[model samples]
Target: MTSADARDAGDAEAFPTVQLDLPVPTNVRVRTAEFVKSSVEISQCPKEGPPEFAVIGRSNVGKSSLINMLTGRKALAQVSKEPGKTQCINHFIINDSWYLVDMPGYGYAKRSKDQRREFDAFTKAYFKQRGTLAMVLLLVDGSIPPQPADLDYAAWLASAGVPFSIVFTKADKKKKGGPRALSNVAAFKRALLEARGFPLVPPSVVTSAATGDGKSELLAFVASLRGMWEAAKKRR
Candidate 1:
C-alpha cells in the first residue's frame, strides 16, 4: 500500500488519546466535515456563527497537511508543494458543529510588499475583532530549531491577548529515532518563556501528517476548546 493508504489504515485503528493536561474533556469525535467557504477578509467569512479555530504558520509549514490529517480528509485543504498558496481565509465547518479556519501563511520573503501589508492588516484585524474565534493553532516546523518569525508571531499573539496553541508539524521529518524535533520544541518553549518573562506556556502538540501522529491529540484539543466556547456562549 502507498504511504497515504497506510496512514489511512492506521487512522482506522484506535489511537492514543492526546493528553492536554487541561480540565476539559476530550471525548469528542468528528462525524462529518464540509468545506464551508473561503473569504479574503474576515468580514466576508460565514455569518452563521460557530466557534472558529484558525490554523496558521510561516510559509510551507505544512499547515494544510496537518488540517487534512486532523479532519481525516485528504483533499479538504489543498496541499501544495509551493509556499504561500493559501492567500485567503478558508473555513471548513466540522460536523456542522464548529469552524476550522485556514489562514494565509506568513514570512514568505518573495511576497510583494503590498501583499505582506495586506496580510498583516487582515490577520491583525481578524485576531483582534473576531468574537467567535476560539483559538489559533500555530503550526511550526518541528525538524529544525525555532525560527525568528514564529517566535515574533507568538509574541505578537500574546501581546494581543489572543488565545492560541502551538502545533509542531512535520515530526516525521526528524531523523529516525532522534530527539531533534523534541529538542526544537523545547527550545521554542524556552524562547517563549524567556520572551514573555513568565512561567506559563501555551498548550502545544507534536504532529505528523504522514504517520498520523498526534492527530487524535490535536482533535481532542480542539474538541476541548470548543466545549469551553459553547459553555461560555451559554453563560452570556
Candidate 2:
C-alpha cells in the first residue's frame, strides 16, 4: 500500500457523492432551535423521527460556535475553551422539523484509554446505525493543512460509504486574500482525491463564526441535502 493508502482507505468509490454544490444556495430560515438531549450510546438516541445532520470534528474546531451561528442562537450548543469537553451525542431540534446533532470531537482531545475506546465504539455505531442520519458535516481547521487524524477519519467515512461534506471552520483567521485557508483547503481536497477508493471532492463550505461568512452557502447545502433525504424517505 502507498503512503496515502496506508494513511487512509483512498479506496474506490463505493457510493455516489451527494450533489450539494447547488447553483443557487438558499438561506436557512431558522425559526426555532431547542436543546433536546445528550446520549452516550446509539441505543439511547431519540426514536427515528426527523432527518438528522451531525456536526463532527477534532477538538477545538469551534463546532459549538458554528452550531450557534447556524441556528441563530447565541448558546444553543455549549461552547468550551478546553478541547474534548463534549463527550456525548447532543441532539438539538431545529425549526421543530429536523435535528442538528453535536457529536463529540474525535481526535486531538486528551482522553484516557477507556474513554478513547468508548468513543471509537459508540461513535462508529451511531454513524452506521442511525436511521435518520442525513449528512455529516465534517469539520476541519481552516487555519492549517489537513491533519492525519482528520484525513484518516475522512478515509474511514469514505470506506464505510457514509455521506458527508467538508466544512472548513474558523475562516476569519486568514490573510488578505485568504491564502493560508485556501491552501489548506486545497491540500485537503488533494489528499482525498489521491486516496484510492475516494472519488472526487465532496461538497465543501468555508465558514467563520466570527464574521458569519459562508453561512448562507452552508445552510443552502444543508437544505439541499435535507430535501434529498426527505424525498428518499418518501420513496421508501
Candidate 3:
C-alpha cells in the first residue's frame, strides 16, 4: 500500500459512516430536461446565453451513465457500448434554465488520425470560445489507476484557464469496504500535485451510477454554481 493508502485507511478508521438525507433545492432538481441541439463545431453551438456545464472525459469513462444518474432520468444521455459514440456537442436544457453539454470523448485508439484531429479542433474551439461555460465535469474511471490522458487533460485545462472539476466514476465497481478507488484517487491527486508543483488540485468527487451514490452531491454542487452564475448575470 502507498502512503496515500495508509492515510486513507487511517482516516476511514477514524471516521464513522453517516447517512444524511438533505432536501435538494428547487434550482438543482431536474424538473424537466429536453434535448436542445447537436453541433459538430463550436461555431454551430447556441449563442452566448444560459450558463453551460460541460461533461467530458476519455472514451468509455461512463460519462453518459453519470449524467443520467445525476438527472434521475434514464436514457437522458444515450449510453452506448461502443466507445467514442458521442461525436458532437450534444446539448440538453435542464429545467429550461441551464445547459448540460455533452462533449465528444477523447483518446480513442480506433479513431483515424484525421478523425482525432477533427475532434481535437472541435474540443479546443469549444473550450476556448465558450464564454458562457460555467464549469466542466471531467469524468475519470475510478476503478483504475491514474491515466496519462486524464492527467494531461487536467493540466491542459488549467493552462487554458478553464474551470473544471474531476468526477471519478464507476465507484461501485470497487470491492466493498476496499480502498482501491480511494487509493487511486489519492494517487491521482499526488500526481497532479507533482505536475503542477502546487498543493491545490482540482476538486474531485466519487460517483457510482449503479447505486446512485454522489448524485445528490453533484446536483447540489451544480445548484450552488448556478446560484452564483445567476447572481453574476444579474449584476451584469
Candidate 4:
C-alpha cells in the first residue's frame, strides 16, 4: 500500500464517496452557445431554473475529452488536437434537470496578455457571480504532478469560498506501478496540502477519459445534487 492509501484507510469513513447510481447517457443534451471572451458577455448567462455545474481547467487539460466521457457521447464537446479550442462558456442542459457549464480554460499559449486577461475576467465573473451555479469541477492533469498554477488557482477558489472539487485527469497515461507516475501524483497531493491545508479541499478522484475511469462516480456526484436542486427550487 502507498502512503496515500494508508492515509485514506485511516479516514475512509470521513471522506465522502460520490454515489455512482445514475445510468450513463440516459439523456444528455449537449450544445455550445456564444463564446464569451470578455466580462460583459459573461453577464448574459441564462437565468434559467436548473442549477449549473461548471467544468474548468488550465489549457490542454482534456476538459472536452472528460466531458465526452461523462455524457457517454463521443464528440459531445469540441475535442481538439490543438489547444485553446474552447474559448467561451459552453452550456449543456442535462435531462432538463441541470446545466453543465464549460467555461474557457485559463493559461493557454499563443495568446496576448490582453486575451488572457479577458479570459480570466470572464471566468472569474462566471464563477463568482453565476446565480444558478451549484459547483465547479476543477480539472487537474494527473499525468504530471500538480503545478504551482494549479495550487494557486485552488487556493484562490478556497479564499473566495467557491464550491469546487479537484478532478485528476489522464489517469490512463500513467503505467501501473510506475515509480515516476506515482511520484508525480504524490508530489501533487503534497503540494495541494501545503497550499491549502488538508481538510479545506475536496477529495480528488483519479480519472481517465480514455478508459472511462471514475466516470460513474463523477455522474453519481452530479445525481446526488438532485436533492440540493429540489431544495433550492423550493426556496425560490
| lDDT per residue as tens, model 1, 36-74 | 888987779888589999998998899888879988999
Candidate 3 yields a Cα-based lDDT of 0.80
TM-scores of the candidates in the order shown = 0.85, 0.85, 0.86, 0.80
Per-residue CA lDDT of candidate 4, range 1-236, in tens? 86655554454444433333333343222333232222247656666567878888988888978877887777767888788888878877666567677777888878888999998888877788887778888999877766777787888887887878788889778534455343445556666666557543465666899999988777766666655566567898
Clashes by residue pair, model 3: none
lDDT score for residue 59 of model 1: 86
Clashing pairs in 4: none
Number of the top TM-score candidate:
3
How well is each residue in 85-134 modelled by candidate 2, as lDDT tens digits? 77899999988988999988886547887887788778778988887899
Model 2, residue 155: distance off in Å is 0.5
Candidate 3 lDDT over residue span 1-236, tens digit each: 75654775574444322222333444768888888889997778988888999999998998888878877889988888899988899998888889889888999999999998899788877987899999889998877888899998888888898888888888777533354445666666767777655447666677898899888888887888788787777899
RMSD of each candidate?
A: 6.8, 7.1, 5.3, 5.0
| Full candidate order by TM-score, most accurate first | 3, 1, 2, 4
Q: Please identify model 1 stretches exceeding 4 Å from their true place.
A: 1-27, 175-182, 196-198
Give me the runs in candidate 4 sitting further than 4 Å from their true place.
1-40, 175-183
Output the TM-score of candidate 2: 0.85
Error of 2 at 208 (Å): 0.7
